[model samples]
Target: MMTFSPQLEQKFAKMLTAYPEGKKRSAVVPMLIYAQDEVGSITPELIDEVARRCEVTPLQVDEVVGYYSMLHRKPMGKFHVQVCTNISCLLVGGMELYEHACKKLGISHKQVTADGQISLEEVECMGACSWAPAVEINYDFHHHVTPEKLDQLIDGLRKAQ
Candidate 1:
């Protein structure tokens, strides 16, 4: 069985406490997210551990994982790049930006680089319409990105690794 670090255990406890009585199940999603943030991907052990803590069935935790887009069953790259191509972004050259990133990274959507340093995904929306043509590397959002800027961003991330 995989053990969660003390810090993660404390976070889980804090999250569980934030909910009212009999609502522990509500913490499932966030708990899984936090767990993934630490361990990468939703492992069987994590599903079981979360299920035990939330007092829900392992199957229930699995269901929750499958429902959320942010949750992943497999490990992603160290830097996961998500480009928004929704209408708001599309109107501002988001699709072109995505193409530029794909070409630059030499990887298609949902594909990781051969070195496992980066992964790319074309998302529908990132809720950054006003900043249109937004890109997210991991949790940080970059607004109004151009092809040259994307190159710089990717190059920077590569160098950081």
Candidate 2:
């Protein structure tokens, strides 16, 4: 049987309680997030476990995962770096920033570092058009970033790991 940490179990319980009867499926997103935070990615076993807890089918859970950019099936590093390269950001050197990050980390998009400290991805709009060239390291958002700033951020994450 799949097991989550005690804290995650509590969080899942609390999340499920927030939904009314027959609406437990609404808890799928947060549950998957917590599970992924613990496991690094959305595994098939996690899909089935989340489905069973939410009273939904594994296919239903899989569909939810597919719909969200934040969800992933493959393993990622401890820090997942997402660079936005949407039109809004691209106009302001987002692609350049992404390339800089790739060169700095020596890894291409959707690839993890050898030590598994960081993973990089070029993503779509993060709804921060006003702050173009924004990047997300895990859950934290950094806006109006330059290559130098990204270097500091990534280096910090590496050290944190």
TM-score leader: 1
Candidate 2 weakest lDDT stretch, 10 residues: 152-161
List lDDT for all candidates, in order.
0.91, 0.92
TM-score of 1: 0.95
What's the C-alpha lDDT at position 105 in model 2? 94
Candidate 1 lDDT score relative to the true structure: 0.91
Tens digits of per-residue lDDT for model 2, 68-109: 877889998889899999999999999999999999999998
Model 2 pairs whose backbones collide: none
lDDT score at residue 39, model 1, on the 0-100 scale:
87
Q: Estimate each model's TM-score.
A: 0.95, 0.91
lDDT (Cα, tens digit) per residue for candidate 1, span 1-161 = 46688998888878999999999999999899988988888999999998989999999999888888888898888999999999999999999999998999999988899998899999978799999889999999999899999999999998899
Model 2, C-alpha of 56: deviation from truth (Å): 2.0
* Local lDDT at 141 for model 1: 96
Q: What TM-score does structure 2 among the candidates reach? A: 0.91
